[model samples]
Target: MYHAIAQDIIKSIMADEYTTKLPTEKVLMQRFDASRNTIRKAIDVVFRHGLLRRVQGSGNFIIKQPANSGTILNLSIGFDRAAMVEGGPLVSQVVTFDKVQADDRLAGQGNIAVGTELYRVIRLRYLKGTLYDLEESYFPRTVVPFLSTDSVQHSIFAFLREAYDIYGSTTENYVHQVRLNDERAALIGVPVGDKTMCLDAINYLANGDVFNFSQTFFVYPDLELYYHTENIDLQK
Candidate 1:
């Protein structure tokens, strides 16, 4: 019932010219002929999905649709599963490809020794032609060999899975608020010191082998991040 009402509201918003502010609870109740509980549930659905944001003083306002950005992380599922779902135009451009000795941070994340050879792959991502994120990834040399510049033009995960049957089953992710420094800002085409969100992820294969360590910076002004999580019953 609430889902039906929510769909109708979404349809109405899409069909309208002006930005659609959600009506008051009373008005929505009247229109949908729903109880207060039903209307509230319907609103919660859209809010959780990033369609709406509520201001303390102002009523609920529609969050402008993300230009073409789609949620990139699904905590409850693997990356391969999520990629198969319908979504936006996701694209990647290789920025840097080189071999370097791992430092303390890189070694720690990859569970490798310091000074071990590591393949560094940097990429810029676009969503529907809009620059969305800048990512830097490090892989232990023992895991991937002869990684060429052209290999990063497509999905790294795809390449790894197809070539070596390697895929991440577990990931440790950390998110932090950061200010982009000059070099990073320039790479992402944003002004220096721009507010950004940084994500550091270390991914492990089913065998508990650390395969990839990555840091991604998202320029906040032009890009948005959406994260979703679901609790799964592990007892089964």
Candidate 2:
């Protein structure tokens, strides 16, 4: 129930329904028919996203508002190609991880032949437990045969090194807007018709072998993708 309330308030904030401080806890309790504990928990969830600041003597105040809380994604210079900065702590909630057969489209993405085996993983990324994106990855089983739930819970790159000595990889990134399905919409705190940023990436191994192909869906309103370009003359 608290989760529902939190999401409702978040939706309102996203819609620009409220810019000032939230109503009193008692008022919210009456509005939502929830207990004080539930209301506080809900507010805490919002607070974790840097949306609200709780004052000791007074009450919670807006901290980030809407425009400032969007996430930023980047390609780190030489390592950790998957790093992105969203609001709050970045977390991955594993949805499903299974060994599946790679079809034609999947093979093209992984640079492998059709019918090859691949591990398909779906995860919902959270910023301080608020839904950020829906990430789906296709990893060749031959390349990462030892992939496990524990390894995937955190950073897959780190786990690859610890288990298989696999290191850095070159990545190809593509960005576009995509409409989400109902399931994905619910996961990312948006409606079905709403469009979101989609990042399609393929990572290669040190020896130029294909490692992982991933797609991420981001829903936060304020987001920026950074790219460093050289040799282009601004004077031109």
Question: Over the stretch 1-236, how does candidate 2's per-residue lDDT look in tens digits?
Answer: 67567757765654556676788999999999999999998887566444566677788776442344456565322224333463444678899988999888888766788998888889987776667778898888878887888877777865776678765446777889988899888777778878888888888786887778888888655676655432357898
Task: Using TM-score, give the best candidate's number.
Answer: 2
Instruction: Provide the lowest-lDDT 10-residue window in model 2.
Output: 75-84
Alpha carbon RMSD to native, model 2: 15.1
lDDT leader: 2
lDDT at 223 for candidate 2?
70
Model 1 — TM-score against the truth? 0.61
Instruction: Report RMSD (Å) for each prediction in the order shown.
Output: 11.5, 15.1
lDDT of 1 by residue, 47-143 (tens): 5544566877777787554456444433222333214112433577887888899888778766778998888988887766767678898888777
What lDDT does candidate 1 reach at residue 141?
72
Find the number of clashing residue pairs for candidate 1: 0
